[model samples]
Target: MQITHLGHSCLLVEVAGRRVLLDPGTFSSFEGVEGLDAVLITHQHFDHLDPDRVPVLLERNPHAVVHADPESVRLLADKDIPARPTVDGEPFSFGDLTVTPVGAQHAVITEYVPRIANVGLVLRAPGEPSLFHPGDALDAEVPAVDLLAVPVSAPWCAVKETVEFVRRIAPTAVVPIHDGLLTDPGRGVYLHHITEFGRDGGVPVRDLRGAGAVTV
Candidate 1:
């Protein structure tokens, strides 16, 4: 399988000769991205699902299946974009690729902010390494995966929590997501600690900011 970090939390995952784009949101520009077999969203947050722009993306990839959390499904439905709900533990198949939705709630930002439905994704296929993208939560009991996309920076989490989340999963390698708002130096600081403290302090951390398509 191959993955391309298309800015922030948006990822273009290509496997089994199919392309799946995750979270083409306000933070990421997926204007030219096409030929998607599916468009998977974790939540309705603007950074995860840009309702205004998603319609355009769907229009571009007319054949792409849309799957999102229930709340996000409603939001998309309002825009006349049909989407399937990504129920927890339920799996969706696209030929040889299998995408499973896991987790149910977004992390608690604060007592004042009401939590929303958020579901992460676990993707796998024959002859390819399994992968997990944990949306906005660090507390999900995710299954084993070869690659784990960690939300290294966000308003609801700290660098310490990011490192611990990686250790808890203990994947073969780690990648950064939800870092759309960080400055270069700030991003450096978060990754510095994540790399130094995650998984025996030696887990391979891949920051796919400028690098092109990465084979995993």
Candidate 2:
């Protein structure tokens, strides 16, 4: 499987002769991207689902299907995007890839803020390593995967919690995500700590900040 990080949590994943784009939001660009088989959205947050860019993405990839949680499906329906609502444990297939939706809610931001629906995805294809992308939540019940997109930084998470989450998942390798708010230096520090802690746990973490296409 080939995964290209398109900034923040956006990933263009190519496997089993199919292309899947995950979370093309305000922090990332889906410009010039086409011929996608599926677009998997985790939630309704602007940082994870851009209202303006999604229409353009649909224009570019006319055949691609949009899949999201129920709340996001409602929002997309209002925009006339027509997204299919996904439930936990339910699997959706696109060509040779089978994507199973997991989790039901986003992480809590604060006591006053109401939590929204979020669904992480577990992707599997023939002859390729399994992968999981856990949207904005850290406590989702993710299955074992070869490649895990770890949320290294977020409003609901800290460096220690991120490290512990990685240890709990224990994927073969980890790719940092949800880091759009970090500056270069702050990103450096977080990456260093994550790498160190991941090393201690016998897991290698790959930093995809500027580099692209890490194969698994």
Candidate 3:
């Protein structure tokens, strides 16, 4: 399995001849996101949804499928995409992968109602360890994996929270996300904080700089 991090919460996982993109933000349409076989959206948010990009994606890959929670389905249906709604505890297959939906909470907004169908994904890759992407929540019991793409930012995610979260999961390798895409690009410094968080928890952290790509 090969994984490419397209910044923010987006990732491109390629196995066999199929490619699955997870939580693709505007980055997908930017470049390197064409020909996707499937997409797994964690929730409905401007950055995660990127409605402007879907139509182009559909045009490029007519057989591509998009999977999301109910709220996301309703939101996409208005846009005329063939989106499949999913719920927690439900499992589905895409190529050689078996994906399981895990519960999560939406990122807190000051005045907006949180999208309640937020989810984390547990993708079991053929001949490789299962990988987990914790959407907007950090309270989940991390599943075992060869690689764990854990979120390390957002106002609610502090150093202590990351420390505790990593300790609980104890994945072989940990890569940080959801931090570098801040409104103020200077906040990229916060990624440095992840090292201490992992040090305190005794979990090894992988560097997320550049376009993160690794063969698992």
Candidate 4:
């Protein structure tokens, strides 16, 4: 499988002769992406689901089916974009790829902040390594995967939590996400720590901050 880090949590994943775009939000641009088989969204947050760009995506990839949580589906319906509601543990097929939704809610930001629906996705294709993208949450009990998209920076997460989460998942490799807010120096600091710490645990973490495609 090959994954392109568009920016932040958005990724363009290609596997099993199909292309799937995950979370093409405000932090990333999907201007030229086309011929996608599926689009997976974890939540309704603006950073993960931009109102302006999603419609453009639908227009470009008219055949691509959208999968998201119930709340997101309702909002997409208002824009006349049909979306399937993702149910935890139920696997949905997109050509040769199988996507299973995990987790039920977004990570809590604070006591006063109301939690929203979130779903971490586990994707697998024939003869390809399994990959997991955990949206904005870190509490999901996901199955073991070859590649894990880790949240390196966020309002509800810290460096310590990020390290612990990577340890719990124990993936073969990690691609950092949810780091749009970090400056270059800040990103470098987190990347250095994660890479050094992950190395000790037999996991190689790649910093895809401003790069192109990387095979997994």
Q: Mind sharing the TM-score for model 2? A: 0.96
Candidate 2 lDDT tens digits, 1-216: 888889889999999999999999899967988889888999989989997789989899999999998999999999899999989899989878899999899998988989999999999987899989989887777767888898877888889988888888888888888889999889888888887886464578777766777776
Indicate the residue-level lDDT of 202 in model 2: 58
- Candidate ordering by lDDT (highest first): 1, 4, 2, 3
What C-alpha lDDT do the candidate models reach, one value each?
0.90, 0.88, 0.72, 0.88
Please give the range of 10 consecutive residues that has the lowest summed lDDT in model 3: 183-192
Residue pairs clashing, model 4: none
Indicate whether candidate 1 or candidate 2 has the larger lDDT: 1
User: Best candidate per TM-score, number?
Assistant: 1
Ten-residue segment with the worst summed lDDT in candidate 4?
A: 198-207
Clashes of 2: 0
Q: Which stretches of candidate 1 lie over 4 Å from their true place?
A: none
Stretches of candidate 2 exceeding 4 Å from the true structure = 199-202
Question: Per-prediction TM-score, please?
Answer: 0.98, 0.96, 0.85, 0.96
Q: Stretches of candidate 4 above 4 Å error?
A: 199-202
49-153: candidate 1 lDDT, tens digit per residue: 889998888889999999999999998888899999999999989999999999999999999999999999999999998889988988888778999998978
* Candidate 4 structure quality by residue, lDDT tens digits, 85-156: 998898899779999999989998999999999999999988899999999888988877988999889998
143-175: candidate 3 lDDT, tens digit per residue: 577667877676656666766676677777777
Candidate 3: regions farther than 4 A off: 27-30, 107-115, 182-189, 199-201
Worst 10 residues of 1 by lDDT: 193-202
